[model samples]
Target chain A: MSPRLYVDFVRRLGNMTLQVRLAIDTEILVLFGPSGAGKTQTLQAIAGLATPDSGLISLDDTIFFQRVPGKPVINLPARRRRIGYVFQQYALFPHMNALENVAFPLAGRRDARERAMELLERMHLAYLAHRMPHELSGGQQQRVAIARALATEPRVLLFDESFSALDRPIRERLHEEIRALQAEHRLIVVYVTHNLDDAFAVGHRLAVIRDGRIEQIGRIDDVFIRPANQRVLDILGIPNAIRARVVEVGPSGALLDWDGVALEAPLLNAPPGAQVMAYIRPEDIRLIYPDRPLSRIVGTNHLDATVVERRMGRHVHRLRVALPDGRQIEAVYPASSYATMSLAPGERVRLALRKESIVVIAVHSDPPPIEEEPRLDRAKCADGCPKSDPAPVSPSPS
Target chain B: MNWPAFWLSLQVTAVASVIILVIGLACALLLVRVHFPLKILVETAIMLPLVLPPSVIGYYLLLAFGRGSPLFEWFNLRILFTWQAAVAASVVVGLPLMVQSSRAALANVDPVLENAARTLGASEVRIFWRITLPLARRGILAGMILGSARALGEFGATLMITGNIPGRTQTLPVAIYDAVQAQRYADAHLMVLVMTALAFAGLLLARQLEPPTPGRRADQSAKASV
Candidate 1:
């Protein structure tokens, strides 16, 4: 089946050049990225609000923008695109009340009021039909904006961080509402958000954008489990990455020498003597007190470490452990587990690195350095420690 | 009281204000929305009458519409020293006020709302009529009132172009000048009082019609609706 939306565009905006290509089916495709990553620019190009320097954007065979190297370009105006867009600010007409704003797109058609009322009802805002934009709260205004967009029954829906302006409770509620609406209508949605939780909550698939380029695109679980590169892993907040040298290769797996410690990981596609980076999720690392019997630790990949710090998170306790070789790794344990184990700083512990959970990624040649160090309070591990340390161990796949 | 001059001034001001409103609104919309080469030049030209002396503007108007000029030679229309000349002078002098306020009001409107309207299938014309025009109505109305007040008090330009022809082209301010020259102190006082009262009323009306300040708009709306 043909994809619902196909977009390939290159546009120069000020000092940045936005170049993106995407094909989306009828699902919520969340364009996830930091600010100024061109997610909104891509949406504007599809909605016909901004023109691309050169490229084609088509929705279900209808070309919204098309320009070849030597051919005449066909660019449809925004009014003709039949795409619904909810602006980041909600952008409801201040002069019009709720009902009138929703009815605006349906003007010159029959049953405009009835249809508008139906949409307002669907949004649970019928009682506010007569309230002006200023009279309504932020969430209510956003709901009206959504109702207005739906009044046109557009072919595609584009939301540019529509919930970023609302409170958390309201934002969460709207996320569920929009998700249900997408499922019920089978609508193609391209949602742009900088918040990772928002992306995970509303997106069936996530597209990681950076510097006007799509770094990776996949199902949420796939992208979270196996990020495309270090950038993707960093953006996803994965905490544990260790640089290791391949010491030996076997049919089943490869043995890696991490700081002179022999570690066995799942087989990766690399030469036996090549350097690679191994990534491990903090939650996957099992921690045991030294009092526990060594026989209970079945894995050969275990490390004796001393807890350097303990940070309490909303749902988990983060333990920063310094390895025998002075390398630091982060581990996450549920609050209950940390409480039951009575873990504290300065205590010795055994960390079991699960072989299956190790992801080996080939180190690219001098990958671009992260511009801003990830915030320590939010970072799961000292994953960024490699940047400060010399002889950076390249993380490899398991 | 120079009742004829009083009636004529009112007529001239009303006609000039209506003309200024239409032209000023169109110019303001273009100035606020469209971008083109020499845009700053066009804006500076629109504002020239506001800074130039009234007699200078009248002198230029006289050269353009005077006898033997293109207007009279081509169209065989005699405008100088007539009521039409007075109206023309008033329009020229009042245009800047109309355009300035209207442009400011249009510029203050949220452009995102207009873009939203476009994506919602609104044609450009419909979006302006339904969204932009209504939102900017307060400022445009103030512009019209200010324009009218400026037109009513026009003297030097009217006197230069129309020559203060008594009972014919003399506006209130021109009549006041004529009364003072004739040493008719009572007549001058009456005309001055009437002009002052009318100008004051126009200014007061404009002030009342001005849109609420940005921070106060929500509070004002809540109070008004309640």
Candidate 2:
């Protein structure tokens, strides 16, 4: 089936300060950005709540809005455009009960009561029909809003931070419900959100907007692994960045020289002897046994490193390791990895990195970190038992 | 001063208040919801009676309704120095109060709810009746109560426009004036007590219907309703 919505437009927000230029062809296009990036404005424009100065908005061959010079004719009113909008606050009528809110659109229409009941049933809110908006829980109110929006059987759906008010567990379930509904309906959803994690969770195609301009947009994996620029990298919270030089030009790919140690990096079209900042995800850097059979000195210098600081992350342990020049780099090891490794603070270990995962940001750089001594390493197991702490500087040569 | 004059005053006030509630509500809807040129001017013109002396309004009504008058010729009905003319005067005085308060309340309903309703395939008229009107109902009710109170207290314009023709045009206020002229203050006191009770009740009801917020109130109420 053809795409329901094809929006190729640039809209200037009120007073022409912020501009939103978007081009997308997805079942669900997630508009992700910080506040004032025009995310909600974009949703409003799509749902026909806000008018754009000039743009062609087409949904399945219907022209909703278009501004042509004197003969402008491509404008359709919001009611004529079959788009359902679920507001952030639910926007349910406080005076009406849950069923009435869901059935609000059906009023004066034939079989309105039956249709409203059916919609409530679909949203699993049939039993709470007579409950007012305040009486229902936050999650139930949201469902009523969803049902009301879908009651009209609109071709397009728009959301303005619909799950922002709910707690985590409820938010997760709502996301799942929305996902399930999208699967059933060939819906063109224009969703707005400020949370990157939420975007990553629900977004099949992610659009990162900064200061009203979409910095980058692509599939989730591509955007996460190969961000368009430094700003995109920062949005994903990947913090381990080091400035490097091309130490050696191998037949396979370019070797990134960090300080005096060479690291393998996936290169594309870059000539030998180039300077770049390498972005390494903490998860990919595997601390391994230096002499293990599976281990190879893939880079010029596989450095011996001592564990310094260890902190708890979401379901994992974050460890900071010290290199030779008093610089620390953070890496994550699962709780299972720490349990099996029997590693303690200040212990020496080898770090392994796959070539494909290391993203090279083509930019100017200072130098790779070189930590002389381990500073904040936790001298214990995952159980928090004390082990021998390492001295300031461990002079281990492989 | 007589029973018929007293009854005429009560009847005219009741009919005038009802007419004001309907027409004033329509005016309020136009002012608050629909956009047009001279909106502010029209709004000011409608609210002009609130500040104008009752005798001034009475003079205009007299010119409009008296025998061989242009307004009398246009309406083709007997109104001058009659109960209907008294009703016209009361409506003229009471209208501004109703329209002003109703407009304020309707302006406060949420535009989002009406838009949402429209998106659900409701016609413009349907949106007004179903979404906007119900949401702004409290405000409209308040305006009606206020109009009723104003109509009850209406005196100078009503007295001048519809002259004191006993049992025909003479209303409670006029009857009170005649009772005082005849030195029947005790009889006037009963009418005064009734009028006072009605005015107080209307004001109390208006206060009850007044919106919680100064400008905006409920969500659907802020939308267009005309």
Candidate 3:
């Protein structure tokens, strides 16, 4: 079957230019970006609320917008596009009660009232049906807006940061509710959000947008685990991006030289003597105390490090460890293991860097010097270790 | 008391208010939401009557609708000294109030709500009628009331175009002029008192219809919940 929606457009507003091309099927595609990244603009173009300067937007077989140079343009009005959009502010009709607002689009239909009531019932908002928008709470108003959007039975639904206004608990509940509704109705949903947690919780696929361009689009896991570039990695908040030099390239993998220590990472396209940024999540690094014997995990790189800081998380303790070669890395330890080990600042530990978890981001020659401090400074340091220089590197075994 | 003049003024005001309401709403909607070339010029023209002297407007109306003008030459019709001329003068005088208030009201209606309505499959007409019009009802009503009050008290324009014919076209304001000229102080005082009461009532109603202050609305909603 054809994709549910396809959009390729280029629009210029003032000095900012928004260019995007995307196709979505019957799944929730979350447009993830910071504010002013053109996420909301994309939704507007698809719903026909904002016109694009050039390009085509099609839903299934119906073309909603098409404009080519020296050709007749076809731009359908928003009313005829049959796309439902829930605004960030809810946009419920203040002049109408909840029921009347939901029934508004259903006007001229035979059973608009009954259908509107049914939708309210499904939203569990029947009790507030007679209440005006101001009388309803934020969450209730959002539900009413959703019901109103669905009243027309649109081909696709667009949500522009709809849950950002609610508290955490309410937002989560609404996310789950919307997810269930999308699945039940088999809707083509495009949700926009700047919050990573919201995107992960609601999106089947993720599209990372920056500066009006979609940098990457893929399954949530793939985008999170194997980002498209260093920018994507940084946006995803993947910890432990270390600068390294490619010293040896073998068929199996490449050996990266960080300071004086050699680490093995998945083979990349870079030749020998090329600079690359290696990324690994802090949770993927396994911590072993100096007193305990290291596990016999194969194809793993191990380094002796001293804990400079430890931060207590909800379920894990984040430790900022300094390698013997002066390189700093972060690792997360389970609360149970941290309690059992009784680890503290100035304590020595062994860190196992999993080979499969290492991602090499290619870099051109003449990379900028690395900053000594790790990005996450939440961990309070107990030891008086020099912030600029954690340790001095000794001669390598090689 | 000139009952015929009072009745004539009421009829003229009633007809003028209806005409002003329709045209004013259309102009306000266009000014607030639609973009076009020379928009500022059109807005300025609509507001010209508000700042111009009433005698100036009356002079223009006399030149346009008087005998031998287009109304007489092209249509072979003469409205001078007629109640229809009085109605025309009232409509022109009252229009600025209607257009200004309605424009402000329509501008205040959130564009997001209209866009939301559009995405929900509402046609432009339906969105205007069902969403924009209802949301701006208070301001529109205030505009109509103010415009009607303005039409009722219109004297210079009415006298210039319709002439001061007691039973045929003399309105309350014109009748008051005639009474004062005739040294009928008691009759002039009664007419002034009645006009004052009506204008005062309209102003009070418009004030009541104004959207509640933001803080007051918040407090009202809070108290409503309690």
| CA lDDT of every candidate | 0.80, 0.70, 0.79
Tens digits of lDDT, candidate 2, B1-226? 2678667767877898789988998898888768998788888889899898877888787777776886667778777777787788889888988888888778777776666776666678877887677777888888878887778677898778677877777888888888999999898988888888878888888897784632243333212110
Better of 1 and 3 by TM-score: 1
Show model 2 residue runs off by greater than 4 Å: A10-12, A17-26, A69-72, A107-110, A210-212, A230-398, B36-38, B66-70, B73-78, B212-226
Residue A218's lDDT in candidate 1: 80
lDDT of 3 by residue, A172-222 (tens): 778778887887887889998887767766787899988888999987655
What is candidate 2's lDDT per residue for A101-144, written digit by digit as tens? 77777767788888999888988989998888878898999999
Ranking by TM-score: 1, 3, 2
Docking class of 1: acceptable
What ranges in model 1 sit over 4 Å off? A240-303, A306-398, B211-226
DockQ for each model? 0.28, 0.20, 0.27
DockQ of candidate 2, scored on C-alphas against the true complex (2 decimals): 0.20
Winner on lDDT (1 vs 2): 1
* Model 3 chain A poorest 10 in a row by lDDT: A373-382
